[model samples]
Target: MFDLFKEKLADAEQTVAFGSRLSGACESPVCIYLHGDLGAGKTTLTRGFIQGLGHKGNVKSPTYTLVEPYELADWQVYHFDLYRLGDPEELEFMGIRDYFSDTSHCLVEWPERGEGVLPPPDIDLTLSYAGEQRVIELQANTEAGLRVLNKL
Candidate 1:
């Protein structure tokens, strides 16, 4: 029931602001996949999103650790950067299902690297460079995603 939603971000701040807006639409127990090239503002967007959800501290990419967990007042957020993943099986070994509980929110970057190991995303977010700015697109693939889009 959701169509495409697109926006142009004039700079990093705008990207973050857009993310803050998106956070308002995000509910718990959902997975979001982020697609973008290096330095394309993926982490920046996520920072705004987490912060917008009332996280007071820093929100950085888990480039080395692969995953970062944040405990907010009402929800658990897990940010995953699988760029350095040596094998998708590592996810199963780590009990990935435990991290994606009914009360958790997952934002995954480089999801292609996870392939069959990762769960399908409810929302697919793509960020691309447009001249000196960036363009963002959001697409919904599930009923939960459609609800998030409605909130948007």
Candidate 2:
């Protein structure tokens, strides 16, 4: 079955809080694909997720860098933004395969840009503008994702 969850966030803070909740339910070795337009709070959600997973420093989008690595006590989190990717082939050169490990959590923004190069997402999260607020819909594509949704 496809496990699903939806929420309407009143503001950026609420969106972040929702992301934090998701972070709490996630286990390592999960790939999450974030789909949203510009200024849709993808990075904000990522900030909350990383913080909730026990990171203390500032969380920034990996827009230019492509990927940012966070080494936590028990998990290695990789935040990837493929918005600027000129070609999906660039991923191979960056050693993208090395980032998604059995002990890591990967949150990718603009995953469609990577297309065939990106790993299949366990959970696919779509954020959309709902007037001045935002609506987030999460869909589980794998068993691991279903478990996470159940926890949520």
Candidate 3:
């Protein structure tokens, strides 16, 4: 349930733990849209997920760049930060379709910005800030998403 993300991440450790589980639960190619305001811990949660999948680096938000792609031992994590995007069509210019050609896990931040150009997401992770805490809501929009949530 989204109520899970709404629960306190407390610190990076807890966030990482949750991400680790999420990573392990992933089975098929997935598209996850992260909805949240600025500084809502979307990146932090992603950082944990990447770590769980064996990625080692600074998991920074791809705000200005639009996308941060990573190829790990167990997963192909594409973190798309569309905050700087001017139009959904711009995704086409970036060869966005190629990203979905196969079995790769995608975690997109601000997916609303890319709209029609992007494929339907398996899950939607919406983050809202309640003061110093973050509220995350997970919506499994596809069969893949259902499996992830059900497993958790």
lDDT of each: 0.89, 0.92, 0.80
lDDT tens digits, residue span 1-152, model 1:
36778888999999888888888887657899999999999999999888888999989889999999999888888999999999999999988878888888899999999999898999999999999999999898888888887887
TM-score of each: 0.96, 0.97, 0.89
Decide which is better by TM-score, 1 or 3: 1
List ranges where model 1 is wrong by over 4 Å.
Answer: none
Candidate 1's TM-score = 0.96
Which candidate would rank higher by TM-score, 2 or 3? 2
TM-score, cand. 2 vs. native: 0.97
- Residue 60 displacement (Å), model 1: 1.4
Q: What's the alpha carbon RMSD for model 1?
A: 1.2
Q: RMSD, each candidate, Å?
A: 1.2, 0.9, 2.4
* lDDT accuracy of residue 66 in candidate 3: 86
lDDT of 2 at 128: 98
Of the two candidates 1 and 3, the one with more favorable lDDT, higher being better, is 1
Tens-digit lDDT track for model 2 on 13-106? 9988987898999865789999999999999999989899889999999999999999998889999999999999999999999999988999
* Residue 23 local lDDT, model 2: 90
Ranking by lDDT: 2, 1, 3
